[model samples]
Target: MLIAHLSDLHIRPQGMLYQGLVDSNTMCEQAIAHLNKLLPRPDVVIITGDLVDEGLPQEYAMARELLAGIEQPLLMIPGNHDDRTLMGSTFSQPYLSSTAGPWHFVADDLGPVRIIGVDVTVPLEHHGDMTEAAGAWLDAALAQEPTRPTLVMLHQPPFLSGIPYIDTYACRNSERLREVVQRYPAIERVVCGHIHRSMQLRFGGTVLCTAPSTTTAIGLALDAEAEEASYVEPPALLLHHWKVDTGLITHWVPIGTFRGPLPFA
Candidate 1:
């Protein structure tokens, strides 16, 4: 099974620019086109969150329209920038449990992988927390299909990336979540977004990785006092190819056309 992972779309109202500079909408359209042209189409697409810039009805409408271009099954969870209720209403699908509090669900029908999406966003806040209830939910979900190849996805990463600015609002109480994940050996990967740039870290007993945004990338500043900034870096996405022998292998694919396929000398 091939899974295409996209994150931090930050779609704005049609014609509006993200942060009044980058054309996130247009870039997202390009990313979608990039996905559609893949040689072996992805079996499923999982978006980690921040689907819109602001939690507005218009933004959700635009997000819905833009995401409609995807040709494969889609699963999404909320990020700090998203309004759970509004997003649930806009992209109603069976994978989502409801159009209400804490959008979390399990999808077992998508190919050979079991996808468990956990919502850790604190409503109207920038930080995320894996509450005791949410942890219990995840524990039970994993128990249901103990032996299935599983992928757990959330918005904010459970581990701290060295970037100091974003880490201030990073997922809190993640140790609890990590403990739960450690017990479940079937989890192939814990994928996330929100950091903008691609990152990978070892967490629990599995690999945790973050995808680059389809729009702007948060500047990579490791200094303790560095100011927050974004750059128009090459937008990209992640593809995870899974097979019995190979397990799961990820590829970082940059968006847009580039000359290639030249024979090696």
Candidate 2:
């Protein structure tokens, strides 16, 4: 099964770009249109977070309408720029029956794969945290048998990406998140999105990948010693393909066309 992993749309009014610089809405529109034209449409669309620049009701309303056009099942979580209560109330569809828990944790079974999503937004904080409640919920979810090849999706990454600005606001209790993953051997990959850059790291023996946002990306400044590092980069997303017989393979597909279409067939 193929899954489209997208994040950080940061949708806002047409004229309202972050700090009056980036045109994120246009980027999001381009990404969605490209997604619609993929040869094998994604089995699911997992948006890690930062759905809005400011967690406003109007922003969420606009995002809700834009994403509603997707043809596949969609999942989401909250990032630093999102309001948990508002997000929960806005997107309310479950993969299973309504008897399951609320909007915090969502799980969907796609044939031989099980995709589980968790929200880690900390109210009023720019950083994110995987609370004790969320850990316990994950533990319980992992305990279930008939565990198909599992993929855990969240907003903030549990591991550092060698960048100070992004690491400072990453998942606070990463060890707790890792411990739970170690317990669940079925977990094949832990995918996340808040970094706004494509990255790969190892956590609890599972492959941890951070997908770049569909909006503007913060450049890789792992070595820059400046107080605040910044750079402009292309927006991108991830396409993750999982096979029960084989394993999970993810491709970082950058949105928008570049200068060339080199024919390599």
Candidate 3:
């Protein structure tokens, strides 16, 4: 099925601009409008996380309104910036229960490739962590559908991407996560956000894909002496499609006003 994978919206209030440069809210609204206008709309939309710049109640309200334009099922997990209780309240979907610490949800059926969302958000922290229980839940979910094609969605990546700044705050206990994933051959992909740049890597014989930020991108500096943030890159999102038999395919769709029907034959 076609799935629109978006992450790092960081949607702020209407008048508040992000980093004094981009209007984060408007950018996200534009993305939603664009998605609505796509010819064959995605069957589902999985939001990796950092739905808001900070997990404010008002932010969640604004986020809910901004995301209402999505015409299909919308699934979300928490990021380091998200507050689990508040997000869970605003999310309000029956599947987003707090019993799992972070919302760990699974599809009841395997007809369209099962999807499970793992929450790695840690309150008042800039890093992510997966509890032992969370790892066990992941194991159980995979066990439930050993032969079905499955995709795992989380906010923080389980593997390092060479960006030292982000790597410092990446998902803690990655070894545990890797161990769980290696045991599950049914997992076709692992999707994450937070790096703010589109990246791909091989982990546990599965593809780990990170979408670009809806607000701005984190520059990819594999090694640098200075530790700071830069805004040289533009905003973007990801479109992923998968089927039980076909595996996964992803596209990096940039977010902005583009006029493209250029001839490229």
Candidate 4:
């Protein structure tokens, strides 16, 4: 199965732009168009979070319209920039393993993979957290099929990236979340989007990584005095393909103009 992952759309109103530079809406539209034309079309698309620049009702309306171009099943969670009620109302679903929460969803429909999306969005805050109940629900979902290939997705990453500024908003329940994740070996990858740049780490026997934003990227600054934001890197997404015999493989897909392979070989 092929799962296309993109994040941090931060889609704004028709004329508005993110950070006075990146045109998030146009970037997303182009991404949708590009994904639609890929060979062996993706079975589903999982957007990690930051679907809008602001958590406004109007933004959700615009987001829904732009995302309508996706030809495959779309699954989303919430980010610090998303409003739970508005997003949930806009994107309705009934195939989830548990409908107990507004942002958590579990999709088992994929032939060989199960998708478990958890909401760690903390209202009015840039950081992320998960209630004990959320952990319980996740435990139940993974416990249901311990040996099945599962992908756990959330907006904020459960592990820390070297960028100290962004790490300030790291998931608050990482310790607890890690405990739960470590107990389950079926989890192939813990995917997320928040840092707005591609990064990978090992956590709880699983690979924890963050996807680059569709709009702009957050620069990698490991120094203690570095600022919070920067856009020196190109935007990108992740493509994950899974097989029963070989586990899961991930490829970083960059967006925008580039030179072609001239058949140098």
Candidate 5:
């Protein structure tokens, strides 16, 4: 099964720019188009939060319209930039529990993978937290289906990325989450998106990967005192391909038309 992983769309209201500079809406549309044109379309598309630039009704409306272009089953969670209530009301699917409280759910029927999406975003705040209750929920969920090749997804990565500025908003109390995940070896990956860049790290006996944004990438500055910034880097998405014997393999696919398919004879 092929699963497309997209994150940080940061969609703005129609005719508006993201952060008053980048045309994120257009880029999001292009990303959707790129997904539609894939030869063997993905079985599912999981977007790991930051669905809009702000938690506004207009933004949600625009996001709904743009995301309607996807041809495959889609799953999503709330990010710091998103209002859970608005997102839930705007997009209704079987995966969302409700428009109130955290949006957590498990989708076990989407092909060969079991997807468990948890909401770790703290309302009206940029940072994330893994509360004891949330950790317990995850533990129980994973225990329910211990042998399945699962994918655990949350908006914020549970570990620091070494980029000091962004790490300020890293998930707190992550050890609670980590301890539970460590017990579940069947988890193929712990996927996330919020930092606007593609990153990977070893975590909890599995790999944790953060997908790049469909719009701008957060500037990579490892200096301790570096300021926060963003760049109009080449947009991209991740494709997680799963096979019975191979488990899961992820590929970074850049968006937009590029001259290629040249024979190397």
Candidate 6:
């Protein structure tokens, strides 16, 4: 099974731009079109979050129209820039039936794989947290089907990226999130988006991957003295392919023009 992972759309109005420069909407359109044209279409597509530049009804409206192109089963969760109410109302599905809490955790079986999504958004705050109730909900969900090859997805990554600007907004209760995940060996990967860059690391016995922005990407500045910065780097999304005999693997696919797939000699 193949899964397409996209995040931090930062979608905005037709003429509007993000951070006063990036044209995210056009980038998202190109990414969706790219997904539609893949030879073996992905089994599932999950956008990790930040669906809109601002969590406005109009923004959601415009985003919904663009996202209609995706042919695969697409799943999404809340990000710091997302408003749960606005998102849920516009993109409601059977999987998002929860009403009482900020957690929108749900599990879907896809024959050889099970995709589980959870909400880690802190209201009106850029930082992320997994509440006690959300944690219990996840633990119970995983307990139900512990052996399935599950792919857990959330907005903020539990581990920190080297960039100080992004790390400050990472998941606060990381240990709680870790406890639930480490107990379930079936979880293959904890995929997330929020930093607007591609990063991966092993944490709590599982591989954690952070997707790059579908539009713009923050440069990789690993030095302690490096100042925070972002740029209009080549936009891209992630593809997680599950091989029964070999296990799961990830690929970062850029969303733009490239040379032809010439025949090998």
Off by over 4 Å in 1: none
Which RMSD values do the candidates have, in order?
1.0, 2.5, 1.9, 1.7, 0.9, 1.5
Clashing pairs in 3: none
lDDT of 4 at 181: 92
- Per-residue lDDT over 29-115 for candidate 3, one digit per residue giving the tens place of the 0 to 100 score: 988887777667787888998998877788889898999888788888888887777777777655755644668898645347788
51-119 in candidate 1: lDDT tens per residue? 998999999999989999998989999999999888887887686657686878998998898888999
Report the Cα lDDT for candidate 6: 0.86
Instruction: For residue 252, give model 4's deviation from the true position in Å.
Output: 0.2
Local distance difference test, each candidate: 0.92, 0.79, 0.82, 0.85, 0.93, 0.86
Mark the 10 consecutive residues where model 6 has the least summed lDDT. 99-108
Task: Give a tens-digit lDDT track for model 5, residues 156-239.
Answer: 988989899899898899999889989999999999999999999889889999999999999999999898888999999999
Which residue pairs in candidate 2 collide?
none
- lDDT by residue (tens digit), candidate 6, 1-265: 9999999999886678887788888889999998888879898889999999899888899899999998877788889998888888888555766643474756566547788888898989998897798789899989988988888999998877778777889988999999899999989999999999888898778899999999877778877777878888999999999999866899999988798877885
- Candidate rank order under lDDT: 5, 1, 6, 4, 3, 2
For each candidate, what TM-score against the reference? 0.98, 0.91, 0.93, 0.94, 0.98, 0.95
TM-score of 4: 0.94
lDDT of 1 at 251: 92
Clashing pairs in 6: none
